[model samples]
Target: MELDFPKRKIIHVDMDAFYASVEQYDNPDLKGKPIAVGGGSKRGVVSAASYEARKFGVRSAMAGYIAKKNCPDLIFVRPRFDRYKEVSNQVRDIFFEYTDLVEPLSLDEAYLDVTQNKKGNPSATLIAKEIRKKILDKTGLTASAGISINKFIAKVASDYNKPNGQKTVNPEEVIPFLEALDIRKFYGVGKVTAEKMYKLGIFTGLDLKKKPLEFLDQHFGKSGSYYYHVVRGIHTSEVKPHRIPKSVGAERTFSENLSSEVFMLEKLDSIAGELERRLQKSKIAGKTITLKIKYSDFTLQTRSKTIPYFISNKELILETAKELLYQSELQDSVRLLGISLANLNTEKKKAAEKESVSVQLKIEF
Candidate 1:
């Protein structure tokens, strides 16, 4: 059956205070207490803070000392990713029942397209509710969901009524709903971008919608076009599922073969930037770096090296990618350049080591 685009239904489900909630769920004494999931060292950062902790302004990513100052009674717990991953699978199993088009945004959140669900339910609201209830019943934790015609609206709606709540914005309401939203709250528009938009007098989605595509492009480059359409309810991003990806990286095939070492280095930089974006989007990083080069004659050469620590930053990724690029003398001019990060580390330690002044990984290239 051909699914109708106009009638497409998307649901964004997010677990509530996922890590801290999991800690509370497993240990009853921690319930209703102000708790944070992360390392307790003075230099550590809070990975997740419970609702009680939020009351005192404690938040995720805040340094341990700052979080403690905000909530003196804050209790700290180390992250147990294995437990979280187990529960994540349980929640995902519920999503798969409704639609296979489930894209996990993180260990605790996902977007599901249910335009033509297995249950044959016409109401997307019902499916969101059922999924939430199943999650609670199976995992003993609460989740919030947003239902709408597209992913952007659905993702925003999910946050509106959070911590065990549900919200739905019907097709007719997408416009007014977006118009009333703060630019800072738009999906993918981070604090820095929001501040830039504020400086441009674009504080609300309504303000953003008033700017022409040309004006936005001049001000924001390629992303300007994205904002223009997203504000007008024109997002069409699909729910791409990566059930089990062997590797996560990006590659570019050139129309013209590249031979100069200087030009090859520049291309590697671009490839690294794209790779970083993918890793950030998936909330994952890896230690293994691979460089694949395809010559103009169709011959291929691949060089790879594994480092001690996981990496997901542009500078370090580019650093390693460049090393891999120079590993062996080129056999011929390159037609395509690819960079990949395998040996993925989906579970980031809650108590990460003190922030190093520089990123240094032990590797042989």
Candidate 2:
């Protein structure tokens, strides 16, 4: 049985240094200086860093004090989420001008399918340039784009030229491009996965392609098959216009660790309240309530319970979290507490049956 693969023109547009750039654009004093957004307090974690700060090893998720140590003059600014959302909406509006097949990955990035765009332009590369320019013109900030046959490659290509640039992997160049790519550069392969691939002597796309399907499956389980397909440039996931969320959650990291249950209960109640507000905003409910605890030593723990009925109230969320908290004795002083709801009441699609594609259709660039 022979099957044909659909050819798609996908573009991934990512805002360059979004939070830090926004800060810089809003305040003239911070432009071209090493700056980080968020992570100013002793316990705060850096959310984003400008390219200037990145030069000194200041990175997102790093401890605030450590970022300060790396770049002594680094200015840390508080994040204005409302302002960022306003800018994000403006950029999203530009994308809608070209196609309604836009899938937002975050406030700063999205995937667009412009195979038959409104502009009637056949060139995806040109469309990417137009989108980036419009974003800059409207927001006074720059964006980078990648145009290719699918989302994965487009996402990978978008990072080739940082700050403000674009890369287009033509249809004919997809396979060779994948073959020459460094295994670590693959979008889904993180640090741990790359190290594992190195141990297996799969250092490049060609090395990955050399392994048989069974050998890959034996070692990587389900992911092995994904590696096998992606290395050959055969991604089929569509650009969804409305991506459904899997869960709703909220968390807080305390400035000081709490040892007593009395102190922790107050924190739990507040955390549950935040979680309830998030669920309410989304107009969703769930049956599974999870409690997350992060100890002062940095070790993490989670406990969950699945009730028969859905719930979206603070009282029920707090009650469940408290039960999970006392289920076991405290191992050490806790520095963070969180509440999350999963198994949401949303229209989740069932997994599609896999089919074999034997025919490789020619795609014109």
Candidate 3:
């Protein structure tokens, strides 16, 4: 069966060792050293690590003690979330200058739909290169980018080169590229899934492509359908722009519910910070702020206020959330405290204008 859709130009940009790189970029002394960002305490975990640390078998999510053991000279630094968020916003603004079809996956990565771009540059590869240069110039950091015709391929291609690099998989190269990739490198195929594929003799993309669709479905269930299309170099996911958020809220179920206002406020402050960070990353401001409270007895109540102008300030979010917490009638020990930002600014122009000239050329032909 032939699938019909417009040929697109997609690019994925990923910052290299985002948090750790930021630290090194700011402190010249830290350059080329094995560095890990996170807790230095015994119970702390590594949130990000530099390439130097990765060389010594240290990685993120590993305990600080273990990471230290892995690299005797490893340097551990505490996470400065606020600073990281600031850098993330700067990188995103750079993306907007190229094309508006930017879909951020996290503070460190995003996808751009550059089928139609502001500069009218015909080569997506050149655009990717320009973006990398701009990022280095603005943030003093490095990023890797992948350019392809779809999200799946773009995402995979971005990782082909690391630290500071760019890779492209033109349409004609897609089939051979997919066929040669190891099964484990396929998106969404983790350790457990790879083991299952190994048992089924699916060791490469070519092996995966040969499997009957029904057989894949029987083994992998719903996700099997996705694997079927991916192996054939087909992906239809759009580069969804960051726009009006459907829901703006944060929630945390405590390890133990307590009546202490101090503890509740501390949790609320963290949640409020996250909301502000997300808002800034999305380049959106919200007018409505909602506070959600869940009692130990499982009852829930929400209070919200709509402001005249959109707000993305961290202080405002925290202050409004605290006020809502105080306004609610506390009938029982609180088990969950949540905050959300809603009713976001949606008037910003979408990225990537339609190709009027290209359409005209097609009509004339």
User: Candidates' lDDT values, in order?
Assistant: 0.86, 0.90, 0.85
Candidate 2 local distance difference test against the native: 0.90
Candidate 1, residue 259: Cα displacement in angstroms equals: 37
Query: Lowest lDDT 10-mer window, candidate 2?
Result: 356-365
* Model 2 spans with C-alpha error above 4 angstroms: 1-4, 213-221, 260-262, 297-299, 303-310, 313-316, 326-332, 354-365
lDDT of 3 by residue, 1-365 (tens): 34333378899999999999999988999999999998756656799999999999988877688899999999998899999999999999999998889999889999999889988888899999999999999999999999987899899989999879989987767778999999988878998999999999999999999999999999999999999988887787789995445666667867688686667888988888888787787787888899988776667788898889889888998888888878856888987888888877765556675321111112110
Best by TM-score: 2
Output the better candidate (2/3) by TM-score: 2
**What's the ranking of the predictions by TM-score, best on top?**
2, 3, 1
Question: Best by lDDT, which number?
Answer: 2
Residue pairs with clashing backbones, model 3: 100-351, 248-340, 249-340
Considering TM-score, which of the candidate structures 1 and 3 is the better prediction for this target? 3
Error of 3 at 51 (Å): 0.4
Pairs with steric clashes in candidate 1: none
Candidate 2 positional error at 95, Å: 0.8
Comparing 1 and 3 on lDDT, the stronger one: 1
lDDT of 1 by residue, 1-365 (tens): 12222446899999999999999999999999999998666556799999999999988977788899888899999999999999999999999999999999899999999978999887889999999999999999999999987788899999999889999987666778889999988997998899989999999999999999999999899999999988987776667786556589888878578887678888888999999999999888899999899876667788899999989998998898888887778888887899999988763344644331211111100
Supply candidate 2's per-residue lDDT for 202.
93
Over 4 Å off, model 3: 1-6, 243-365
